[model samples]
Target: MRVDAFDFELPQELIALRPAVPRDAARMLHVKGGVIEDRMVLELPDLLDEHDVLVFNDTRVIPAQLEGRRGEAKVGVTLHKREGLRQWWAFVRNAKRVRDGDTVEFGGGVEATALRRGDDGAVLFEFLGDEPVELLLERAGTMPLPPYIASKRGTDERDREDYQTMFAKEDGAVAAPTASLHFTDRLVEAIDAKGIGRETLTLHVGAGTFLPVKADDTADHKMHSEWGRIDAATAERLNAAREKGGRLIAVGTTALRLIESAADEDGVIQPFEGDTDIFITPGYRFRAVGGLMTNFHLPKSTLFMLVSALMGLDTMKAAYAHAIAERYRFYSYGDSSLLIP
Candidate 1:
């Protein structure tokens, strides 16, 4: 399909620079059976039943945005993937100034030498000291905000807590699973009281999520791989819930992708631990997840394509039109949508 088919006009002011206070205060648009409804994120518990299970991505967003200097030339780095305990593949700004084997010095004395360059134009850097890369990042890095928001304003201390969900635990992701950012402790308690089961899996969201689809056609686009894991026990539990006629509600596209990658043709989820480059587009069959709760995506983005697949393309376009006219926010810090095909 032509990528241009997914394009839509969005007013610049609709993009959210900051998240709604209390997290759950964000707006939610419910799309089910070709019908759209306006609602609030706090009302999610009312939309779900006791037999439904919500799967969340527990991968924590790391402080992956870094600033450094390569012989007086300023360099910006956003770590995308972990190659080893001390080695990472990062997309560098002003990359031409730093060659393979060049050392870049970051804040707090943290330094790394570029081991090589990846085919995708990313630099492979190996941290130079015994201190774990995680520690070095904590000392010298800032939260990796989505380029849409970061481009409008500078990142600050508020984003540190706002970008992270209450379920964050495993540390690896460079980007936050934006859908999960709307969750709060109060919302969790409410959902639990309503007898809805919640489970978590890890998918270290990479900076590739922010990359645009420059391809003219969907077939020409290649999705960047991200590491994810689902254990046997969790898989078994999810299968059991489904056996009892429970619907699997994925909390974000990341969770939806990982769960779909772990499921078989029969829709039975299996234990998985590897990288997934699953590119969901229209005409794709969804086997594991039945419903998705996610943020409104950008025009011509892979995420929009996924949502279009879940619902009909025309239906999503109408839904998005309503969202825009209603003055709902957009992007990572934007409003939420509950999609049920």
Candidate 2:
């Protein structure tokens, strides 16, 4: 399919610079059976049954955005994937000034030597110290905000808390699973009280999520791999829930992708621990996930393509049109959508 088929005009002002104050106060658009309904995030628990299970991504966002100097030239890099305890693959802002083996010195005693550049244009860098890279990032890095928001306003202390979800625990992701950001303690309690089952898996969202689809056709686009894990116990529980006639609703695209990667042709999920470059496009058959709850995505993005695949392209286009007309916020800090096909 042509990539332009997924393109839509979005007004600049529709992009959300900040998340809703109470988080749960954010609006949600419910799309089911070709119908669109306006809803609120707080009303999520009422929309599903006690037998339904909500799958969440527990990957914590690390402070991966770093600014440094390679000799006289200024360099900025966002660590996207962990290659080792001290090695990371990062997208460099000043690639022209960096060369393999060149050391970039970030402030607060943090520095790394560029090992090589990948075909996707990400540079591999090995941190030059014995201390953990997480500690080094704590002293030097800031939250890696999506470029749509960061380009409008600078990242601040508020973003440190706002950008992360309440379920954040395992540290590795450079980007937060935005769909989970709308969840709060109150909301979770409500969901639990309603008997909606909840489970979590880890998928370290990389900066590749922010990359645009420059390809003219969907087949020409390549998705960068992100590391994810689903233990045997969790897989068993998820399977059990489904066997009991419970619908498995994935909380975000990251969770949806990981679970789908773990599912067999029969739709039974298995234990998985590896990198997944699962590019979901139209005509793809969804194996395990029954539904998805995710934030609105960018035009011509892979996320949009995934959502289009979930709910037909025409249906999503109409839903998005309604969202835009209704003035719902957009992007990582935007409104939510519950897609049920």
Candidate 3:
């Protein structure tokens, strides 16, 4: 399908800047068997069967955004993915002036050696730090908010808690598991009380998630790789749930993608850890995931295409039209949708 097939009008005002006062108070759009229903996030448990399985991406969002100085010039660095032991693919502001081989130094004993310039003009850097990179980020890094969010003096403390999920365990993602943002401890308990099963897997959401589909033909677009893992423990539980007439419901596109990527032709999930660049488009046969809970995405983005794969192109187009008309929230800090195939 053409990349334009997923395109829709999204008003700027509809883009959410802050999370709902009570997380679970956000709206939810439920799509099942090509039928769509308007609902609330708190009402999720009522929509599914008691034995259904819900899978979540437990990758923690790191404060990967940093500010560094090139001599007297200030530059912003947002790490997309770890390249090597110390090297990372970082989006550098004012990188045009740094040139190759220039060094950028940050506050609090943080520094990086610029390795090379990428096709998108992003810089490859080898960071200098005795402690773990995660520690460095804790002290000096900023939250990697989306491009749409306007920065103030810098990333604030609220992003530290708001951008992260309650179930976040593994540390790797630059972006948050947006759908999981709507889930609170109380919400989890409510779902569990309904007898629904839950499982956790890790898929470090790379900056690739925000990358738009540049190719006119969606089929030619190449997806960036991100590290994901489904351990034997999680796999066993998930497979058992599938056998019990339970729907394997994914909490976000990241988890859904990894589940589909890790499953075989017979729909058996296996242990997986490492990079995955699996891209799903229309007509692709899904293997494992039976349903999905995900945030509304940017227009013409790979995420919107992923939604088209979960539902149909026609259904998504109609749903998005209604969302735009009704002014439902959009993007990372937005509302969510529950899609069933």
lDDT of 1 at 170: 97
Superposed model 3: Cα runs more than 4 Å off: 118-120, 151-154
Question: Which residue pairs in model 2 clash with each other?
Answer: none
> 1-341, model 2: which lDDT tens digit per residue?
99999999999999999999899999999999799999999999999989999999999999999999999999999999999988999999979999999999999999999999999889999999889999999999999999999999999999999999999999999999999999999999999999999999999999999999999999999898999999999999999999999999999999999999999999999999999999999999999999999999999999999999999999999999999999999999999999999
lDDT of 3 by residue, 99-202 (tens): 77888888888888898988877789887867878888888888899888744234688989999999899988999989999999889999999999999999
What's model 2's lDDT at 225? 93
For candidate 1, give the lDDT of residue 269: 98
What TM-score does each of the candidates earn?
Answer: 0.99, 0.99, 0.96
Model 2: CA > 4 A from native? none
Q: Cα lDDT of all candidates, in order?
A: 0.95, 0.96, 0.87
lDDT of 1 by residue, 1-341 (tens): 99999999999999999999979999999999798999999999999889999999999989999999999999999999999999999999999999988999997999999999988999999999899888999999999999989989999999899999889999999999999999989999999999999999999999999899999999999999999999999999999999999999999999999999999999999999999999999999999798999999999999999999999899999999999999999989999999999
Superposed by TM-score, candidate 3 places the C-alpha of residue 271 at a distance from the truth, in angstroms, of: 0.7
